[model samples]
Target: MVFSCLLFGASALAAPAPWYLWRSKLDGQVFCAQTPPGVGWQRVGGPYRDARCENTGVPGK
Candidate 1:
């Protein structure tokens, strides 16, 4: 049971983290990150399942 639980936990950690697109307020440049990139950046895109900003539930929106 302990081994199974450890395996499950490891799998969960292997999952990709959600990412978001942030636009720089100063330069209008956009970047992707798992969390807000600190001051002067605003969130424009969202909760992407992949690093490339792809794979949202909607198909093409």
Candidate 2:
């Protein structure tokens, strides 16, 4: 039972969060992150699969 629980936990941690480009409303500067940076920032780009914000394709097989 403990091994099964550990497997499930590891699987959950393996999934990566989608990356997005957020544009700062105050300066129009774009930055990448898994979540919104803060107030005055809006998501302008995609839920990319890669860290460089280049993969916009659908995730999973």
RMSD of every prediction: 4.7, 2.8
- lDDT, each prediction: 0.78, 0.82
Model 2 TM-score, 2 decimals: 0.71
Model 2: pairs clashing at backbone N, Cα or C within 3 Å:
none
The TM-score between candidate 1 and the true structure equals: 0.64
Give the per-residue lDDT digits (tens) of candidate 1, residues 1-61.
9999999998876645688889999999997788888899999988786666776532223
The CA lDDT at 30 in model 2 is 86
Q: Global lDDT for candidate 1? A: 0.78
lDDT by residue (tens digit), candidate 2, 1-61: 9999999998986656788989999999887788788889999988888777888843451
**Candidate 2, which segments miss by more than 4 Å at Cα?**
1-14, 58-61
* Model 1: residue 22 alpha-carbon error in angstroms: 0.5
Best by TM-score: 2
For every model shown, what is its TM-score relative to the native structure? 0.64, 0.71
Q: Which one is best on lDDT?
A: 2
